[model samples]
Target chain A: MDIDTLDLIDQYLRGNLSDTEKEAFEKRIAIEEDLQEEVLIHQQLLAIHEQEKISLTNTSYQQELVQMNEILNEEDNAKLSQKIRAIGKNQQPHTTVRFKRKKTVNWFYSAAASIVVLISLFFIFNTPKALPDYYQNYVNWEELPSFTVKGDPEELFEKGEVFFKNKEYKNAVATLSIIEPEDKWYPFALLYLGASYDQLNENEAAIATFQKLASLTTSEEYSKGYWYQLLLYLKTNQKEKALEMKTKILENPNHYKYKEATELDF
Target chain B: MENTERYIQALIQGEDQIIQEIYKKIYPKVLAFILYNKGNEDDALDVFHDALMYIIITQKEKRSVILSFEAYLFVICKNIWKKNLKNKVIQTDVLTLEEKETNLSAFILEQQCFEFYIAKFSLLSENCKDILSSYFNGLSYEEITLANAYATVNTVRQRVFKCRSKLIELIKNDKEFQKIIKWGA
Candidate 1:
């Protein structure tokens, strides 16, 4: 095939051709089997290229998760270290003074008994439901109704919604953050932005976003900010703050998540 | 229904919480299966990760319309472990007869196609790879030119066309590609 024909196919696939040219190309594709096959081949190649991009994006995300996991593991190690130090402090004087052979036997039995109690307590308290369980139970963001807007903002909003719906929380946060303040969907975008941050475990950013939304807008227009903030606190085990938000929600039964909030307990 | 879709979407998007949930919910069963089939904990984790990657790539390729994400994942993990253990004398009673003959072949074919494409992509020049990567990522000609200082808008367009043509030619001429297509038929 000529380079011009290849160029036309490229332009057509990219939706870059003018209306008349696109019509002519479509007419030619109908009659020319080879051209049709070439178009199909071009489309297949494009899909392969797209797959490569997605793979690359996924690799980056995997790296980010690895780093995040390392950070979490370090935090866990630090906490474990602190707990060990506390245990050592509790036993330091006792170990120093109880060096007698007769006391050593009693100390061994007491230590064994203490270990048994610690193990029992660990099993008992470790059964507390996890944060993810609470998230899955309470955080249900329904699919928003589809509507049309006229300009570039419409495209931006749609892209954000696509990321949000696909559960691409990081991508959703990035995309939704670009919505202009004057856009009709700005407030809604902020809400979803907070939701995205919450999903990403960026609780501080999520709380800041919700706080901004709550302070900037009236309760009737942005009650979801409070609702989501309440759930965010609950998911992170901040029951006191969550209860405060819950009381606020209950004070006004007209809030959107009032029923769900009422059903929740510390 | 929504949960299954959410799981698939989460894997594709690489969401942290949902991924952790998947590990919590599904990894234990996969680990148990692998242990029962003469594999260790590390091997089980590796197999599970590979299976998850394969499922994500297959989904991206639009190869399978998943019915049940959990069941599909478990099946894939089991098949992978069995394939690893095929050289050993082991009871193969874990898989249902229907699953044995049907999806396994298709899955293998898809894997072959994916590997072939990756190999072919690796053969392209660095410049072509850069331009084509940007193009496939939905960058406009003007944006591509702006991002890559050496290229003009027109040059970017021409380069993209040439690079894609070369890629298609390479893929078409690949011996494994022919075999894969024939087998997929």
Candidate 2:
């Protein structure tokens, strides 16, 4: 209880006390129940302190994860770039980023579908679906689709349209591709998918997809058809084409979606 | 076995595969921990995520990890709950469980006792608290002295010793804490 005894106890903890002092403190703790009790408390606290470091997902950790995700994304992009260059092919990164974005949108749909599936499983059987909850929750990322775009091409287009209405585009794209010209929904799918590609920062794919959609026959073109393409061009800073699309929109002021298109700058 | 193999490796590598593994293998445990801690489904989820993130960070940082990943995860979650308590955050759960004669029960009790001791730490004078905290934070005597503006390293040393003794006194006299140990033991 005395300051000297307390100081000696502290030094003992620090292992900084001279040998004589340590011996004295040890003796006191042995003979004195009160001193022994104090030692136990200190030791307990020490143990707790040693094992009790803070966790991330604490705000500090979240900040770090954002930084980490950015780094990982950059690494993935680099890997993708290297592989693309190695392919004895002609492709642009704009296209790659577009492809990545489409993948991202597909994942978004997969997540939505997984939720629907989970809800159905819960309701139907009051149990988890075949997918385990943990992995099921992580189905935030979808893989390439399993459904083929086969059947009567026109019927497939009809099915694709239904899917588009349901917002299942990966399946819709597969379905629609078999139909005439693929143009019935090609413009819409192309533009949306191109945007998806853009969202993933795969610029080249987005531009090419958008351009191909834009070049369809005038009969298929919306009065404001170019707006969608223009948006893609604008996104990639393809000023010439974006401007051209804008001019096309300007010339056909009466086209459907044109008023809305004019109100916006691509 | 293939599923387990795929998931655990993915988890070990910090991939999303562990999310499935966790849902299947460990989510029940996490949910149980949450439910015991007076938490709901949401807390169970948040704690589970935080624990996994902590494990990945620790592993990535090359910390020596020898415990079963399951045990390590629960401990991290428990620690996070304690910090939540200290920060006066919304804490609806205390993870109370019936005393039982099992190693897991003992470990839980041990954690409860440690938490009790840690709570008692706040009762000390701020200076005493600071000195003790500095020591535990791995501050050197010189760093402690410089930070606290003590006259010398000897002064810092003397202060830390006194702080430890005071902490002991606080811990011994806390009856509630003793009861936790008794029930836990």
Candidate 3:
């Protein structure tokens, strides 16, 4: 399509055209098959502009699930193989084949039991220990350098910090998010904002916030944003993503968490 | 009918108890279907999980469903498995992350336009991408101008028009896009 047609379509899609122009465009669309297709494409693009972000979050969520399934599969298969070997040793070849076929139901029951126990143990043992160290070891709000801002923006940041310190994370998110990205405190606000999202169990939002920090900042906090992201992935049990972040952090030794990332077991 | 909506809500919210119930209810049939279709147990598990996620995303986007949830889910799983089979014939390696996104989204959408649009969008200049994203995200032309440090609303509007034109041109000229339109038709 020509630029004029494209411009016209853009105006129409945005409802920028006058009523007469819209009527004319609609009439043209009715008669021209190619124009109808172009309009359809424009509509799809407009609809999808917001969708891509959600799609990405959903994809991340799916990948985490897929990775969990792989881990479960590995453990389950190992147990099954061990059981099959044990059955083989105890029985004749013909009897072993029969036993294997009959034992499928029992195997599933045992696997389910194992998974439940494993999950219980993970929550009981791992969750409490991992989070404090992940947050406390790296984060010291008092030590953070204050960014230069004044008046309403500074007051907003102070209010946000108060909410954060009081553990009112939802309020903190709502308050902190109002600070403009161009403000001096924006990056630091993002740090708190991301942590608040993490506390709220909004993993995708937290990850995206940290990502915005990594991309938008140029100071030491740029790498610190990524470090926090690595920690968030670990907290969420997304080992694959944690490992991916670890690689990115370790790529530059000067990265704020490079040494800490190197010490990670994964 | 209530069960259908409840199950879909469970999927959307990632409610573990209900999601577990869903798995227990659906896995046997999914496994049987896959095994009958020459897939192994692992493929069944993978396809089942993929289908669930696909449903979650589609429901989030579209919010309207005609079929019952289980039937909708099963159809998606079957289609994904069949598509995977075709891909396996062409390449022995497993689908890469991008290929998986393209295929899964394409299957859910019943068209390949999602990936194509994303690819075209990525090829634009970063300024264009940012301006368009802000615009499409419901920022006013004035808001976009302020955010991007453009001189005026008119400048932002012109930039958006030019960038969108470029994006459309890129989409319209792509050979794969033509194929997608034809295939969808």
Candidate 4:
């Protein structure tokens, strides 16, 4: 209860109490509830950490992490030393593929300067300045044949055909989507894209795409895909639509795609 | 991204960036824990090599879905050091352990628990670890005595008893053990 007793108890818990003091403390602590509770809580709190001394995870990895840091620090220090050595040495310029943005302020200042000069020129010589070709050629590509369809679509479409044959729907879709619209194989790309979508279980998207191909009625590719279009209808349980496609295909007896159309059975 | 999941996916996809990121982030805590446990840099090297190898092996052999690669690896490294300590001549006594109950992902727990005794034995005292390791290897005391020089069978008996008690004490005091047992190795 007294300060000396408290000090004795603290010393005892630390295993530093004198033998005589320990004896007196034991006699008092025998019936002292508060002192016992305090002792217990103190020991518990102390032991709690000791208990946690065991590993939560790989102890070595943590050690390695530390060692790794030391190694990295050493390496960084070495690099810094190298940089110091090169204090005034010659260096080669490095050009990385970074986005180099153009300054926009020149447009306003240059335009104001040009307008003033143009007013002077008009007063002096009665001539007009011609605008640059950037805006004039914005949409026009007739002179640029490279931008036009270069017939890669036919070759790519053949690859898509291979994918379709293997039933790789997504690959076929990807292979077909890159085709240029003006390529001879463009019609086939659209048709196969529709079939690929259908295989991927994208019914509505496939149907809408298929309808676009069907609207280009002049293409033989559209005629060939009529069966799949009908098959799509049947798959979606659109019986009326499937039958209508089947009837149209059957009615045109001389049509090159009629055989494949009838064979699908709608 | 969950570091473990990110780590594995990155490794599988050959993404060096993720690998470097994870390697940098978690290496410290692991190093500190191991160094405090009487582990040297060599032990660290072995622990990391073995842990990474195990992760890759498990991933390839079975579709391992590790959510926390760091946690999983930490457990492995700790276990390996413990096992090595026990198997080697060094006799260490484990008395108590404390653990926090963090609900780590299944993949991490499973990876940690998979054949963890290697690490456990390493941390045990030289005598207890040898006895336990021998026992685990299916060797009887007779066989052990035949292999090694013990005065009598009673010595082995006392050793095993003391060792088991010590192991129990170590585990009981270990907080990591507390967290891990709930997940159950």
Best by DockQ, which number? 3
- The lDDT values for all models are 0.61, 0.49, 0.64, 0.49
Better of 2 and 3 by lDDT: 3
Q: Which stretches in model 3 have alpha-carbon errors above 4 Å?
A: A1-7, A14-20, A52-266, B1-48, B51-106, B109-111, B183-185
How well is each residue in B41-94 modelled by candidate 1, as lDDT tens digits?
555655566566556545655544567777878877876676556523565454
Please give the RMSD of candidate 4 to the true structure.
26.2
User: Roughly what TM-score does model 3 have, to 2 decimal places?
Assistant: 0.33
Q: For each candidate, give its TM-score against the true structure.
A: 0.32, 0.33, 0.33, 0.24
Q: Residue B67's C-alpha lDDT in candidate 1? A: 71
| Deviation from native of the Cα of residue A180 in model 4, angstroms | 3.0
Model 3 root mean square deviation, Cα atoms: 21.7
- How would you class the docking of model 3? incorrect
- Model 3, A1-266: lDDT tens digits are 67579768878988899999999999999899898777767766776675431122235445544543443245533343233223323221111000011111223233223321111111122334554445434444343333323332325565566667777775566556655677656777888888887877787878998998898756446886788788788777677787888899999998865776776664
DockQ of 3: 0.08
lDDT of 4 by residue, A1-266 (tens): 34445335546766777788788777776788666544543333223323222232345434433443343235533343233223212111121111112222223233223322111111112343222221121111111111112333223445566666667665555456655566555665676678677767888867777777776677754654455566577667677787787787787776534764554432
Candidate 2: residue A254 Cα off by (Å): 26
Candidate 2 segments exceeding 4 Å error: A10-25, A52-266, B1-101, B124-127, B137-140, B152-169, B179-185
lDDT per residue for candidate 4 within B50-84, as digits (tens), equals: 45544543464346444567777787667656555
Q: Give the CA lDDT, 0 to 100, for residue B83 in model 2.
A: 55
